[model samples]
Target: GDVCVNTLKQDWSPTHGIRHILMVIRCLLIEPFPESALNEEASRLLMEDFEEYARRAKLMTSIHAASASSASKKKATPLSVDVANHLVASSPKSSKKEK
Candidate 1:
């Protein structure tokens, strides 16, 4: 749930690279906070029901974890953090204000 939404905008040096960037992206993907989302719900499916939201989030995490593990075993195009974020954002749903 550690989202570095403004990491690049902060006072940091170039010691960080693509991996770091991807990590932050991945964090957002895994724990998207639509209610407090910087993108204003554009990057997540804000469900009205808390239980349903939790269920969907868990499913997504499991899917991503599985894909990441499989990708880690291979040498070709390993799953980067960015890829994870894309999956979260691309989830098939719409915005619903949390109750």
Candidate 2:
């Protein structure tokens, strides 16, 4: 899993993917973070171009939301208790001050 995602304070770059970029842009409209901007140019554009900002923001939110909602609705993989038990049983104990 990508741990850096949780720590991100800026929008996704184009290389990350179009949807990812949109999600970040949408979030910026919901709440701009100029103080912690990784892309000064983008922040400037968003602030100066209100109409475009709002338009893209609205479109992205709707498109991303539907896809994200459906993705979230899918059932998560169930944990295998038997495999877990076998793993624990097979693992050797740590070296300790034991007789």
Candidate 3:
């Protein structure tokens, strides 16, 4: 697959407040409310036994983290003014002929 490069200056920020994000994180890890579940099956399984859920979650998290870290290592260069200038400077200019 061809590596994709971002060609813009991005804000790349979350709209929601950090407190809300923190609260949700707490709900997920420390005190998961299974009855009011976002994922019913997983939540039910979690309610059955935390250790079981933790074992599966740990394995999945480790697998995901490994992939993500590897991908992050090959960080793509983003297009900028300097890059655009370099591209223009490098491209061959066509010669014009007058009749």
- TM-score, one value per model: 0.34, 0.33, 0.40
Model 3 residue 69 CA deviation in Å: 5.1
Quick one: how many clashes does candidate 1 have? 0
lDDT of 1 by residue, 11-54 (tens): 46576666777777788677765665654334354645566666
Worst 10 residues of 3 by lDDT: 1-10
Tens digit of per-residue lDDT, candidate 2, span 1-99: 121232243543434544454465677557767555556655576779878766876887886665766878996543222322321222234323458
lDDT, candidate 3, 65-84, per-residue tens: 65766878995644322322
Candidate 2: lDDT of 93? 40
Please identify model 1 stretches exceeding 4 Å from their true place: 1-4, 41-99
Computed on alpha carbons, the lDDT of every model, listed in order, comes to 0.58, 0.53, 0.53
Give the TM-score ranking, best first: 3, 1, 2
lDDT of 2 at 22: 47
Q: Model 1 — which ten-residue stretch has the worst lDDT?
A: 84-93
TM-score of 2: 0.33
Q: After superposition on all CA atoms, how large is the RMSD of candidate 2?
A: 13.3
Q: Assess the local accuracy of residue 1 in candidate 2 as a C-alpha lDDT between 0 and 100.
A: 15
Which predicted model would earn the best lDDT? Answer: 1
